[model samples]
Target: MTSDLDTLFSDAFERANNTTKKFAPDVQLRLYAYYKQATKGDNFSYNNEDNLKNAFKFNAWIQLKGMDENEAKENYIKLVNSILK
Candidate 1:
């Protein structure tokens, strides 16, 4: 059985994904980072693509290194709620 947090996280993710509003780059980065941290934890690896956008994304995600998955999910949900407001 999935935990309540996991269910809530999935709901928040669905809400975020279905939203049509445009967000600022920084906000987008935060969302991306939180989602990645929540899902992937510290097991991160990326190809050396040399793409600036990917580099920025990697940096954003790596900055959340060592964050607990549950905490990341909570942060992601909060951020999405704030954005939807």
Candidate 2:
């Protein structure tokens, strides 16, 4: 991504972080997976946690599977746009 696009994506991401909109569980999981894949490739391992919240987060992150960073970023940007709209 170019610097301008990167800036846009970053701003969108920040907006997403600040949004108070309530998303469905699947939507939230998708957003989390996209953000994780975009920022940190597919090289992360979720430590098994006893907490339900942590478990769900880990599963969400793992669901991204083989998604590429650019694709993830694009999806994340799209999701943010949809939410903001």
Candidate 3:
């Protein structure tokens, strides 16, 4: 990845920090929680009380599907790099 990844992650992080102002409070919370779950590991299971019972998994699918695959991969790598630092 290039320096652009750092920039992209920084920009996304800032928007995420202000998610409440940029989106509905519930949407912000959902995004925040789902994002944490999505990037936490290589394994993702949507078979849960909140996701299955509440049908939030569909929204989760949508959120992830909208991401640019390559960019998201770079962001994930960049995020892990920052953590290691």
Candidate 4:
């Protein structure tokens, strides 16, 4: 069964994916990690492959310090959804 939330996510993903190419390094990093976290659970470990897949997350997070978490989450969701679609 599909939910409205799913559709919303799909739309957001489409937007983000199309927008990803223009994202700056910091934005890309956050989007990458945000996508990983959204698809995966929070407890997911940072194993080698996982870390390799997300070389930018750490840097993005660091750069985004002092930023609002909710904004970050929104942006991440959009960015991730974009990449997946």
Provide the TM-score for each candidate, comma-separated: 0.95, 0.82, 0.36, 0.50
lDDT tens digits, residue span 4-30, model 1: 999999999998889899889999999
**Clash-forming residue pairs, model 2:** none
Candidate 1: lDDT of 31?
92
Best by lDDT: 1
* Tens digit of per-residue lDDT, candidate 2, span 7-56: 76798888988988878887888888888888887888766655887788
Which of candidates 2 and 4 reaches a greater TM-score?
2
Flag clash pairs in model 4.
Answer: 13-81, 13-82, 17-82
RMSD to the native, candidate 4? 6.0
TM-score (C-alpha) between model 2 and the true structure: 0.82
Please give the range of 10 consecutive residues that has the lowest summed lDDT in model 4: 37-46
Select the stronger candidate by TM-score from 1 and 2: 1
Local accuracy by lDDT, each model: 0.94, 0.82, 0.49, 0.56
- Clashing residue pairs found in predicted model 1: none
Best-fitting candidate, scored by TM-score? 1
- Candidate 1 vs candidate 2, lDDT winner: 1
**What value of lDDT does candidate 1 attain over all alpha carbons?**
0.94
Candidate 3 matches the true fold with a TM-score of 0.36
User: How many residue pairs clash per model?
Assistant: 0, 0, 0, 3
